[model samples]
Target: MGIFTRSIVSRKPNESMRLIVTTFFGVVFGFLIGLCFPKLSLTKFSLSTSILTAIDFKYTEYTKLGPSSSTHVSHPVGNNGSSANVTLRKIWVPSNPRGAERLPPGIVRAESDLYLRRLWGKPSEDLTSKPKYLVTFTVGYDQRKNIDAAVKKFSGNFTILLFHYDGRTTEWDEFEWSKKAIHVSVRRQTKWWYAKRFLHPDIVATYDYIFIWDEDLGVEHFNAEEYIKLVKKHGLEISQPGLEPNKGLTWQMTKRRGDREVHKETEEKAGWCNHPHVPPCAAFVEIMAPVFSRDAWRCVWHMIQNDLVHGWGLDFALRKCVEPAHEKIGVVDSQWIVHQSVPSLGNQGESLDGKAPWKGVRERCKKEWSIFQTRFSRAEKAYLKEINSTSR
Candidate 1:
């Protein structure tokens, strides 16, 4: 202490003042740096170098990326044989104009439904009851009696949706249930067309299961509540009530079995099935009465071709939507419906070159089946090629 005092006394007045000012500023600068990075110690030279490097990196990244964007960094080799930087930025999902990154996961509004909401009621109290399941039928006015009977088979828990191909929506109002039901009217359009447009996965996501059915089905022997019970009991994600063995039965797998509650497989004609797990023999249901669990429908909705409205070959490929599909897809034997096989939609087609409208419709169905199979095969091949290359 005595030596420092003597040294300060020996120095010129201006020099002493300069040393005091320099020391004071140096201490203040270090204290401010400490406040900025409390975790980084200034005493350790190695740690200080690391801290400076990190600060430089953050400054460069923030300046380059800017606000309103998030990035995922990846390292890939460039054509010049040097490591290149890749930035994956946020993108807005079509359903949300605000961008998906800003929202919580799974909180998307892409799903919607046919439930009627009142303008005067609070949003939470709008619906007296939220239906757990959905049932849809494509109808012409001629099938009103059958559809009326069919709707009765489903309990109050099911949301009834009717697609009118004959443009007679108001006529269905005669039935008491129609007052509560959702009706979509479009002349000469098929069920698949309505399904693609109206029954979007997001729209029907609230329902536990969905029934896409033919209007001509005789549901006298079928009970939807019981059908849902059997579906859940068997862990069936994709299923249908068994088609009555007596009429309109195309595949043996879907034929009603009297002995069992549910059946997942059937014996097919020789060479009809390459494996027991394949379609026709197993994992199969006719489109007319196919019922899908919510998760299964999401996948199936995407597989429906927009242009191929007939939905002829969809039954064969539906197994793609559910894992271990043979087990997950089955027919509930306890609840069976008779397919009336009415050609109402086919009759809507215009007669061409003196050919019957129905015949042309049948031809179109066959053509669509061929096109779907070819497209599916090509897609599988392309996906496999991409996967193989990625693995390499």
Candidate 2:
């Protein structure tokens, strides 16, 4: 009788244990099977594809909130709401969802070959990872050689974007890498316009660094990989390649020095004193070839005023992006580029009435300086006032 009771109890526990083990294995096996032959209709909210294939997904996630929505802008200032003053500038929406045929002005549709689904460039990952660098150039037909040299140096490590203000897209067809690049060909658009229209900070958030380079930089002394190595080592958030000294040198701080990999301070030349807030000796780099880190570009893009196409007054205010900007911004000397100083964009554009194209641009630049000062002053005052209020 005792043996019978013991056997019965032992058998009950053994059955329970076996049941648990079987259940666990069954669930795991089912999950794996689901992944290999996943339901095609499964969405972001669906058990995320059983966690097997989910980990290696190459496509962008369409979240519960959905893919990013298109931008809709309404002009309230105009009588017919068709025209706008400076306050209501052009309405530009750069990105659209896949299969979206309607698009904003100046937003070119990528050729079928350049679609995001089929695109390949620096990331190496199959559209799963962010690019480390996004290099941009404003070029003309005459600047092809310099642009080619730059593309060759950076294309493997960065996603190269070429903005042709001269309006010819096929000129670079001979270069094999041209097919790999994201090219925007719009006639007479300024560098700033291309940036405002296409390279919006949000659109380029996947990139870690943004290099807004001019077309005429001589890159013989520069290596893109070496420059990046120095940038990472020195912890620079906004930087540029040191310009070759005596090659139409514009600023003391930008001059290449043989002794250093990077420089934050520069000595004042004989006749000029380095102003505390002035550039080339402070946190500023000339727009000719400025490189911006991801976070820094966000702040810089917001500060870009509408109607300021020349971007003349921007370098002075670039400090607004990164705190202690002088320390965070520097010129890399170990890998530097020579500025050819070719005025490619100078001769083209719609000029002011009775004014030459270059002259009209000059006037606009001077006017933008005043506008920038006003905006900066007001912004600083508001910021300080808010800080003081919060501290109390």
Candidate 3:
């Protein structure tokens, strides 16, 4: 017997070990062969048809085969070829709900071309435009005789508004000749007080330009037409002619050094002394020669203190009003005008004697000074606030 068969038989001489040993050996051998050659064991296994029937099997037909008969299926072309079972879903690809529709590249270029063509044509016939100019002035006792003369010499197509303290009865009666020229008179208690009242109603009227001056100022080599042309050329809002002092006073400055002082004083003080940023030296001499644009007139008219007791504050009033408004106030070098400075009369209560008249005038000046102080302080504060707010 083989050694394996002998061992098995010897282990159980009185027992039925043959079947047990045979089954054990078969299981062990099959496992070893399966690990070594897996395909061989499956190919070797064949069950009878009865063995498949012994197992419980169930099958069911589908009521609906989804998308099986859809349009994507490829029909068999020939008997030799295989047919592909494909189904295409009728899905709606979402529209561009939030996306911008792209415009054609040439649309912008076409629009630009059309715009250029339209703009190239001549403008509409309805458009009407013309140059406008307005003239204005203030007159006092000294200016009464000369107002008509100045007006006649400087008159133009411009509308002239003349303000006078000496009433319509004076030498300004000839101004009535020009319907465009208006003469407004103020109550004649004091020249300074009345001058302030003259500015209100006249300034508010609508005009493209305004020219204010004392009538005593004489035009020398100044062409109003040429001056207006320059004004328009430079786009200046406020302009004054270069003033040569009628008194022919030379300007001189004084200097002080250690242990030595140099003084150059003139009895002839013409107008106010010109500073660097202030009006030019010429403007100072010709106080009556300033010409204002409509905008400047409007701004300056509001700042005038009509109740001011004296005429001393007019320059200060002008500087305050014009400087803050960002309007240009410049001296025209080409034009020239002369100022005829006149002395002030003493107060109504004073006698011509040195004691009474001087005292009364001094008292009046003090009263006017007090009024100026109050008004200037208030105006300055308001002006500063306006400027600061504008800057912000």
Predicted structure with the largest TM-score when compared to the true one? 1
The Cα RMSD of model 3 versus the native structure comes to 32.9
Candidate lDDT values, in order: 0.87, 0.76, 0.50
Show the colliding residue pairs in model 1. 111-202, 111-203, 112-202, 112-203
Flag clash pairs in model 3.
none
The prediction achieving the highest lDDT against the true structure is 1
Residues 281-325, candidate 3, lDDT per residue (tens digit)?
A: 212222355567766666666665666555554543455445432
Error of 3 at 169 (Å): 2.2
Provide backbone clash counts, one per model: 4, 0, 0
Q: Determine the backbone clash count of candidate 2.
A: 0
Q: Candidate 2 on 1-392: residue-level lDDT in tens?
A: 99999999889988999999999999999998888664644654354643433343222222223234432333234355363322212222335545442333235544312224445656455565345788999888787877888788884658888999887888788889888778898988778878887877768887778899888899988888888889889888889999989786888888888998898877766546457545646787888899888899888888877678888888778877888887888899999899988766768845778887878767777898888888889998999999999999
* TM value for model 2: 0.65
Error of 2 at 221 (Å): 0.4
* Model 1 residue 64 distance off true place after TM-score fit, in angstroms: 19
Sorted on lDDT, best first, the list reads: 1, 2, 3
Error of 3 at 85 (Å): 74
Model 2, runs deviating above 4 Å: 1-115, 119-130, 269-280, 350-355, 385-392
